[model samples]
Target: MWLLNGQSTWVNGYFYPGENIWAQCDLDCHDVDLVLYDRNGRWVAEDTLLDDLPIVQAPYEGSFAVQVIMAGCRHPRGCAVVVDSDYGF
Candidate 1:
C-alpha cells in the first residue's frame, strides 16, 4: 500500500482476464458509491466504500487501483489504510 497527501491505496497484484479499478468523488453527496473500473475502463464495484475515505479495496479475489482526491466538499482530514502482504522485502 502507498499514501499521498493524507490517504492511502494499493494496486492489484494479479488482475483477472478483464478487471479494472478506480476512485471517484461524490462532492454532492447525492450518491454513495465506489467502483473499480475494469481494464476496459469499466466501473466494477457495486458500492461506495471510499465516500468518507480514500481507500479502495479489490473484490474478494482481486486487487484495486485506488485513488486519493485532494479537492472536494467532504475531504479527508487525516486517514490511514492497511494492506497485508507477506512478500517481506
Candidate 2:
C-alpha cells in the first residue's frame, strides 16, 4: 500500500509469475492508470479509465515491474493505493 501525497507516480520492482496483480485506488483518485512490464521492460498489460481497474496476470516466472499513475484527483487528504497479488511475495 502507498499513500500518494501529491505524487502522481509509483513503481514496484518485484512481481511473480502466474500471479494475478490488482490495484485499487482511493475514492479521491478520480483517474488512475496501472501498467505492468515484463523483465525486459516490455509492457505486459495496462489498465486505464475510471472503471477499467488495473489487473494483470504474470506471463512468466521472473521479477516484473509495476507502475501506477494518478491522472486526476480531488482530495486534500491525498490518495491511497492498494496493490495485491495472488502469490505470496
Candidate 3:
C-alpha cells in the first residue's frame, strides 16, 4: 500500500446522459483517491473512502476520465481499477 509521491493512473472513457457509472480501486490499495472528470476536463465525481477504495458516479453524459491517485504512499505499486456503467449491464 505504498506509492511514490504524485503517482497516479488515468483512464478515459465515455458515458451517456443519465448513465449510472461507478469506479473503484483495488482492495489492497491503501489511501487511494478515485476521481472522475467530464469530457470538458471538468471534475465530476470523486471517491475518497478511508478503506482505499473509491466508487464514483458520473454527473453528466459524454466522455469521462477516471483517475486513481495515491493519497500518500512511500513505495511504488499498482492497483486494480474497476469502472462499470449501466448502459450494458
Order the candidate numbers by TM-score, best to worst: 2, 3, 1
Backbone clash tally (model 1): 7
Sliding window of 10 residues with minimal summed lDDT for model 1: 80-89
RMSD of each: 8.2, 2.8, 3.9
TM-score of each: 0.32, 0.72, 0.63
> Model 2 residue 3 lDDT?
48
Residue-level lDDT of model 3, residues 33-87, one tens digit each, is 7788887778888777764555677666677887767664434565554556677
Expressed as tens digits, the lDDT of each residue in 46-78 for candidate 1 is 444435333334444444443333222333342
Candidate 2 per-residue lDDT over residues 44-88, each given as its tens digit: 887775652577777777777777766555766667777777864
Inter-residue clash pairs, candidate 2: none
Error of 1 at 30 (Å): 18
lDDT of 3: 0.64
**Predicted structure with the largest TM-score when compared to the true one:** 2
When sorted by lDDT, best at the front, the candidate numbers are 2, 3, 1
